[model samples]
Target: MTGGVVFDPLLPWPLIATLGLVALIGVTLALWRGLSGWALRALAAIALLGALAGPVYRVEDRKPLSDIVVMVEDASASQNLSDRPAQMQAAAEALAAEIEARPHTELRRVTVPDGAGDEGTRLLETLAEALAEEPQGRIAGIIALSDGRVHDIDRAPPLPAPLHLLLTGRESDWDRRLIVTNAPAFAIIGEPVILTLRVEDSGAVPQTANIAPLEISVDGGAAQRFEIPTGRDIDLPLTLPHGGRNVIQFTVPEAEGEITARNNTALVQINGVRDRLRVLLVSGEPHAGGRIWRNLLKSDSSVDLVHFTILRPPDKQDGVPVDELSLIAFPTRELFLEKIDDFDLIIFDRYKRRGILPASYLENVANYVRQGGAVLVAAGPDFASADSIWRSPLGAILPAEPSARVIEQPYHPALTDLGQRHPVTADLQGEENWGSWLRQIEIETTSGDVLMQGVEDRPLLILDRVEQGRVALLASDQAWLWNRGFEGGGPQLDLLRRLAHWMMKEPELEEETLWAEATGQRMRIVRRSLGDEVGAVTVTRPDGKTLDLALEQVAPGRFEALYDGPEIGLYRLQEGDQKTVIGLGPAAPREFEQTIATGEVMEPLIAPTRGGILRLEEGLPRLREVRAGRPAAGRGWIGLTPRDAYETRDVRQTPLLPAWAMLLLAAGLITGGWLREGRR
Candidate 1:
């Protein structure tokens, strides 16, 4: 119990001061006049004033509260590398033991884990959260055990006492980090795009004059090695071979005495976009559905369509001026023979051979197909005639031959079993209730996989690969009915777009392909195939370990597998002839961005509190108590302030003396003074 004397004034402070002042002035005047009883008068005045100023002795039953000393532990991913984890654990245990042994100190251990996404070690955030639960007055000190490479130092809370850092990692450690300073998100296909990168050496960098050899690979192809100077940016020129996403990986081989090689490699995903798609739309006869093909190609901003249409049949042309006839002025030789290979897709919409494109020009178009080009034939009534384009030199590459018979009945289009597996028609079950087509040219399948079928399950659409190129034959001209939204229409736009992309050899629209996408540590593996069943996929991790995972069929021709990734790096997947490489998370993780830990980031925060930054390499320091604002750290010891905080459980108060006793005492003193003056 503790007690102290406190004043409880009977009157207001101002009134008490007035009465005291008047009594004092009277006493001083009597003393100046040499009165004999001035001393007794002064003593009486003092007694009266003391009675007016009420005084009480207060006693408090106190309980001492422990001062809280926060011990922040860094268990982030970076700490897991090398021997930092061991060092941190050792320091934590020693500090916890010492704090618990202290007289009135509590240890609060807060473990900081890895941050979300790219946010690195968040030690200050974790420290502040732990402190929010404790009383600030009792937070005597904050001690953190980390590599000191904190990413959120600005969030350091207001420290009432000293904050000491027990840094982990050794001074001789070193690391090499790869920095992708600049990379383009989109690049034109077949064009060289520049990527700027740098290689940095940190912490006790090796004394070497040799240049660093860097290896670069595009789309998981063979890596090309180049020697580059260390600690400087280098511009790399790369060309994308395909028109789709391209994963480029840059790596530097490990050397001796490095902390880790995790940061020595980096990944950059660049999308390969074609400059412009040149499409040639040739019409043998203009009809109601001719505008449908034109509108589809014209709507896309990327497509450059060159349309040449014969407005009227040559045999039925009325007497119009030769110059007025658009067909008379058409340039057919220049398109078919001169720049036939320049076009990515050549669409023959309802075109019949009527001496427009000569036999030699038709042969050139067939040669274009064999030399890695695309052709799409949209057949109509003219396909059944003797002048059919299929009967020309192009018939060598056509997938279907006209049977000279056309089904004129209305029938809904259907996907064949192989069509359901093909990427172009997969997931089209939602559009099964499509509007009927009034006409479909009967054809005999020669070579190719039939996708769409018309009346009696006859071939409506046939896709085939010739040599190094691809071709698509649509045996009907009634697809435009769906574009008019007849009977709630169908996926006309989707089907046409996929069909065009498939003919253009878009990577994502390939029928037989393997790909994977990663989020955090989980991977979603997908395989698209036209076969009945796909074989198991073999996945190669970043560490070169291989695992074969059986894929489950989620939908027709769609196979998937989910694998929990173990590390952050490039993953290679292969199924049949399909092979793809994808990077999970960052190629160089944020944890190892600065593996060689130092207290540079944290020194400023601790210096303001007179705390010291000590390395745990020399072992955990001896904990001691010290006064606030004093130097709390030395060569071998760290100090924590004792808050000496206490809680008052119960309090009692008693007057120094009773009011009646004070009054009686004052009367006796006054009477004595009166008697002495009377004697005088």
Candidate 2:
């Protein structure tokens, strides 16, 4: 209980003061005039003045509250490294026990787990939330058991008491990490792009660890090794092998005594894009469908088209001189022999053998296909003639042979069973609403998969693979009828585009492949194949663990399975001969970025509160009580300030003097002063 004197005035203070002043002056005059009762008069004036200024005694009933000490346990992924988990558990238990032993102190524990994705250790944010929930005055101190590698330090809250850090890792702990400081998200194919990387050593690194062996791999291919010096950035020149997502893995073999290999390997995914597409369009004669090929190739701003038409053969009598006739001689030598490799795709539109291109030039074309080149043949009536290009050396690479027959009935083109699953024709819109074609060349399939059929189910589209290249045969040249919306137009543009890209070796258009797409920790694994069914894919995790994941067919040839990965790193996928690598989260998780434990990150936040950082590996510091505004940490001990906080249960107020008592005292003093004056 506590008591204090308070006032409740009966009259205005100004009026009371004026009356007292007048009475004091009267008494002074009486004393100056030799009045003996002046002292009594002064006493009477004091009694009346005191009554007007009321005084009361106040009391409060109180209950003491315990001081709260917030202890934040950093249970993040980084704290699980090496022996830190053991250290954290030991420190936490010791601190809790000490707080419980101290009188008038309570321990509030907050455990911070790993943040979502690569947000890293959110120790400061967790601390701020704990502080906001408690009374600031009742909080004696704030303690964190962490490696001090907090990602959200800027969010540290204002401290009401000292903030102490019980650092978790040992001073001798070291780590080697591979960091990709600069990597472009998209790079031009066949053009060198610079990737900046560094192999860094942290903590107590050995002198012999200055030079490290680095391995680099693209799309899970063979790795190339190099000796690189640590602590400096190395610029690596990389040219993407294909157009699509290219996964590049950079690794520095784990040093003998380093903390983890997780940080030693970094994965970077760059999308490869073509700078320009060079196409050579060779037309045997000017026909209606010739413009369709020209229009399709010209529509894309990225394509460079070189078109040549054999208007008159060398054997034909033109009846006009070469100079008088407005015709440019075809650069047969430059196109077929010299610069054939410069073009990404070669298209033969209704092209038939003429005296102009000899058998040698045609043979060269066949060689081009076998040496990683693409050839697309669009057959017309000429394809079934005696002079058909199929009769030349190029027929060796051609997927089909002309049967010397032509179907002249209007028939709608339809996808074969294989075409419905092939990337070139799968999921094509408006398939049921396609227009009809006037004619198709009869052909006998010698090799390759038949994707489409026409008139009496004859092969209309055939795709094949030559040694290192690709070849495609379309038996009809009347696909332009679809472009003209005969009966109803079809997806001519889409079909042609997919066919062209597939021949050019676009990664997404491959007939058989394995790949993965990641959203947060969830991965969608996809398998594209031409067979009826594919076996389960074997997934190799970053930690050398393997699992067989079964896939369900979502489309004709597309199979998929969803997996929620528990960790962040590169994952290797394999189905049969197809293999691919995908990264689930960041190549290097933020928690493992700086695995070596240190207190530097928390020093600034702790210093202002006069707190100290002690390593748990050395020993758990003894807890002690210290006064506010003084240093809360010492050589072998940490301190918490005791807050003398209390709650008022009840309050009571009593007047010092009652109204009746004040009146009686005033009357008595006045009467006494009157009698004394009479006697005087």
How big is the positional error of residue 614 in model 1, measured in Å on the Cα after superposition?
A: 2.1
Point to the candidate with the largest lDDT.
2
Best by TM-score: 2
Candidate 1 residues 1-680, lDDT tens each? 99999988899989999999999999999789877787888888888888888889999999999999999899888898788888888788888898999888888889998887768899999988887898888989999898888999889887778999998999899888889999999999988999999989989987892468899998788999999988888898889889878999999999788889889899999889999999999886778788888899999999999997877655665788777654555687789888888899999999998876789999999899999999999999889999899889999999989989988988889888888888998767565678878999999999999988989999999999999999999999988898998776788888888898899999988988888887788889999888778899999998899999999999888999999887778899998889999988888878888888888889999999989899999977888889988999999899988998999999999999678888888787778777887888
Judge candidate 1 at residue 619 and give its lDDT.
74
TM-score list, all predictions: 0.88, 0.92
Model 2 gets an lDDT of 0.91
Query: Candidate 1, 269: how far from true, in Å?
Result: 2.1
Model 1 accuracy (lDDT, Cα) = 0.88
List ranges where model 1 is wrong by over 4 Å. Answer: 1-4, 8-45, 57-69, 93-108, 133-140, 311-328, 427-433, 484-490, 516-524, 535-554, 560-569, 574-576, 619-625, 642-654, 667-680
Off by over 4 Å in 2: 6-54, 663-680
Q: Report the lDDT of model 2 for residue 190.
A: 94
